[model samples]
Target chain A: MSEERTEINSLGEFGLIELLTKNIEIQQASTILGVGDDAAVIDHFGRQTVISTDMLVEGIHFDLMYTPLKHLGYKSVVVNLSDIYAMNATPTQITMSIAFSNRFSVDALNEFYEGVYAACEKYGVDLIGGDTTSSQKGFVISVTAIGEVAPDKFVKRSTAEKGDLLCVSGDLGAAYLGLTLLEREKQIYLESPQLQPDLENQTYIIGRQLKPEARRDIIEFLQEQDIQPTAMMDVSDGLSSEILHICKQSNLGVVLYEEKIPIANETKEMALKFSLDPTAAALSGGEDYELLFTMKQADYDKIVLSEQISVIGYMTDISEGAHILTKGGNKFKLVAQGWNAFQQ
Target chain B: MSEERTEINSLGEFGLIELLTKNIEIQQASTILGVGDDAAVIDHFGRQTVISTDMLVEGIHFDLMYTPLKHLGYKSVVVNLSDIYAMNATPTQITMSIAFSNRFSVDALNEFYEGVYAACEKYGVDLIGGDTTSSQKGFVISVTAIGEVAPDKFVKRSTAEKGDLLCVSGDLGAAYLGLTLLEREKQIYLESPQLQPDLENQTYIIGRQLKPEARRDIIEFLQEQDIQPTAMMDVSDGLSSEILHICKQSNLGVVLYEEKIPIANETKEMALKFSLDPTAAALSGGEDYELLFTMKQADYDKIVLSEQISVIGYMTDISEGAHILTKGGNKFKLVAQGWNAFQQ
Candidate 1:
């Protein structure tokens, strides 16, 4: 963002696309072709390809009032990459398409692509083919991540067997609480433009929301340790919602121990400040981008090798039903309180 | 066309996705997993995978007043498939993500998916994965089509040699004329609500704009004839612009004959009604979704087997420059009047 603004129409569609993609450095050997083609070509060398897609709309998904363009770009790619990692696949390439209103400028998109390239560089994925178009209103982004996995090795939610140790990588609920804080700060700023946003130096929680990373380390560690989860999924939805999906899809019940759920100190502190239950946030707050998985009990010793991993519960027979044993010694039926964007 | 309407929020995001995707019967042998997972899986069976993406925004790329939801759905998929086919590949799967405001009902989405499935059935591509979310404004669709090509057989736009025969498949400019007609009708309807719309029975042009098909037949025909194109791309941004791209990318020049550019009889009639030159319309009016390619002169004999293809030009040395020999025997330097959505 500079004082001088160059209109998008000045460069036209082809010129703008060339400007945006000109700096892309392809990193994947699987990416036989990257950008500047009708379609990108990939040769996975006999590996099964895994693909996932995600769409984000401004105002509905993010308020640009506080979100930086670069972080927005990074998070967009990271979210789709999380889905690929959840499938136990190595992301190799991505196609990103964006539609923006006249409000966006070339410089604005340049800053955004700076973040996109940063993520691509860090994650070692190639920026492949995409579409650039104009929108009638706010900015919209759609990203598709492509990955590869060894044949028959890709994890699925429907394969968690009974007695498997339910686990998760990294902390949960920070991103949701971070969003709550940002929204509050946004409201305050709208009412008092002169006043500065009091983020309370909650950098950890805020960073979780603005620049969350896909749990690539967990996947890599698993690969290094030869510990394959029977079932796994990324927690874009809340942990409770994701747990319900594994249970429903696998036709197995699960007993989640609320006491064992991992929450960072900052997340817990922020929850208490907001008068929200930390456990509740951990269960129902979404967009953590952490990996939730179930592994065989025999691998428990190996799983503990990573200090980031937490054993949350165990899968049970379907007859037992999905439930959560609360820290207060109360057993409650688990329900999917996943954040629904369509909620009225 | 249901008497009862179900609100999208009533079903929630997951429920809506389930309803839309529940009927998908996988049609591709490469699609190992479709929907109901974090990501979809595909195995290209040693063939190189081709991927392309497109995003269409309502009011920007399409007008809902004249475009049926079903046709919009079908066109969205077809446009992406066209990119894949441009690479000389057989499309196998697609991921469709859409964001729509609450102004739409669940039944409306059902109709859109109806057309999506129709295209999938016709193209024999599996609908694998997608993201459905709420938009703050109009409908936005993002589709990524995946295809497979025989190893080292996928085509590129930068491989045309001098003296290669430049060709195009199917007719062009009809879609642009059709859009012009629709816009005028919309303007009339907007200005006078009492007036009944008169389409003038321009079915062919209208259909080209509303539900254009990808040139899958041309690709199939080429494969059957073993006629590999030297340079190739889909005619998306008008013939003049596409030809310029071919020349610039291939580092060669082209001499196009305006008389050889195929314009359907209906297209010519519509252009005349609009008081526009038919050849100019064929050169500058886009959204044809037709194949534009350069083939070896040796393959020229096999190319005529399909009545759909027409030899429009020949590749030339760079020193010859890119020009069009007009019907009146005037040679003009080719300029791209490609449709620019970002135009002020």
Candidate 2:
């Protein structure tokens, strides 16, 4: 990246906004107006809109010491899009609001927006209107994603019934292991400024952490297969915690099989190298951005045709409780050991 | 007000979110789902949706020393709704995402939510979804307001004709004067802790500053009167700057009458007490949250029936330039002195 620094102060707030949003290309026919107005108008044309928001703060969410601005920007958007996909909706538009201190330059912001636009284009979502201002402290990002779905077609977390097959898309626990590796490298670099960090042969894990993509393909594939999920949510706060949410909200119980949990080869290798259990990481780790859903037993034959998905468990009655059977046939109650950001 | 503090950590992120949102009552018929889902679903029933977002950072956009959490929360929602209303639409839902450091208590956040729900009820909008997390520093707020309008009924800022009549709702600069007075009091309070600052008979201006209301009534009245604005926007950045935006975006100029600029009596007196120009304050001060709009000149007679609105100017061809004619017959160029949050 060029070290060409352009002071944000040189351009006023409006000027900076103009500079950033000048290249916005509207891809959605629903987008009647994009930026430059008080608001953006979208006509979904009878499709119900799905909306979700997320806020990412500096230090709390990401450490700039190891995170690139572009990747952070990309991850920021991908996280919100994941929520829309979790609802089984096709994301069509997004609004990105950001606040930064003087610590960031216009070029840095441009880099961030470049990644934002890249993700927007890939997801086929139009970047609509948003607010940009200066923060007195850390960089802050808030994104609101808008997706469209047919009326009564959206999925929820409380719709699963008894005997539904629990499924998740792709592999998990990679992003958490990736974060651990990056933090380790950052500590080494901090202790010895002259030493170059070792991060070879970990591109998949690092990419999972830095530029995690939302499971748009999973959503599309499920729709194309005519498999409507009884309950669905993204694996953002780990598989165990998310399954617990499904059971709790739907007033049902789940019997998860430990052996069936999907863990990538890279994730398992890294977890073991770090003296951690790969199964524990897969069940408790977060930020995988994979799709976790439950479907009727009738879709079993059709689901097996897709290699990208795994049937990890089945929903049981409330009396059975939410539990996971280990490889030794020992059942343990599933607890939400998910990341509690407020925890000390 | 209660000192029985509850640490946000005691209840984890999910717990706190449940506690905060457990009482949300869905009010919109278009809303298919509210909180607790991966994403909120809303069916506009064929109405176009207008969406706008705004991010407010602590110490830059607001000072918490004198800002009550409730008013801050109320103001946050109102400010975003003002934008939706600016589009000639009826606000239906909002998503609020807030991040705060350990400095904030659960009680404080509850106070803020109290104001948020109050504003939601008053505006007949639903709090459909939001994100809350612990920040590493001061509180950060981002709100996305969503509204519904009939097909092709939403107004824009660039559609005003050359001879459109310019109008604004309510008085201006009171909020600016109120901010000036409070800031002065804050300074005095810091310098002399024993002396209680004098703020008697300034409730109007103070309320305008601390708890500004969106011009919902103005939008309703315009709709009831069957008046469609050619162009409209909320005066968030000051009268002069907003008119300049209208002229620039519409590819037209404007002639604003200084004498017609509506500054309240209390605001004028307060400006005089501070040795400031009332007109200048009205022209440059921001956060008024009033509607500045342009309509067909033929609706002048009908618009005058409403005492809340004042016709201040008329649009002109680009050759005429944007200027304000003073009471003394001198014309001056209208420049943007709007609050640039990035300035040192």
Q: Taking the tens digit of each residue's C-alpha lDDT, what string does model 2 give over A1-344? A: 75655554455333544554444444434444344321233446656677888899999889999899999988998999998898888777777888887666555666787788778778877666576677888899999988777766778888899999999999989999999999999999999989998996799999999999999999889888899999898988788888987998799999988889989999989998999878778888899999999999999998797889999999999999988888888778887772331121
lDDT of 1 by residue, B45-115 (tens): 65667788889999888999999999998999999889889988878777788888877765576678778
lDDT of 2 at B268: 93
* Candidate 2 stretches greater than 4 Å from native: A1-46, A338-344, B1-46, B338-344
DockQ of each: 0.16, 0.17
Lowest-lDDT window of 10 residues in candidate 1 chain A?
A32-41
lDDT of 2 by residue, B1-344 (tens): 75554554455433544553444344334444343311223446666677788898889889998999999999999998898888888887787888887766555766787788778778877666667777888999999988777867777787899999999999999999999999998999999989987887799999999999999899889988889999998988889888987898799999999899899999999999998888888888988999999999989888887889999999999999988888889777887762221121
Model 1, position B315: C-alpha lDDT score: 98
Q: Where is model 2 chain B poorest over a 10-residue stretch in terms of lDDT?
A: B32-41
Docking class of predicted structure 2: incorrect
Weakest ten-residue segment in model 1 chain B by summed lDDT: B32-41
Q: Please report how far candidate 1 places residue A318 from its true position, in Å.
A: 1.6
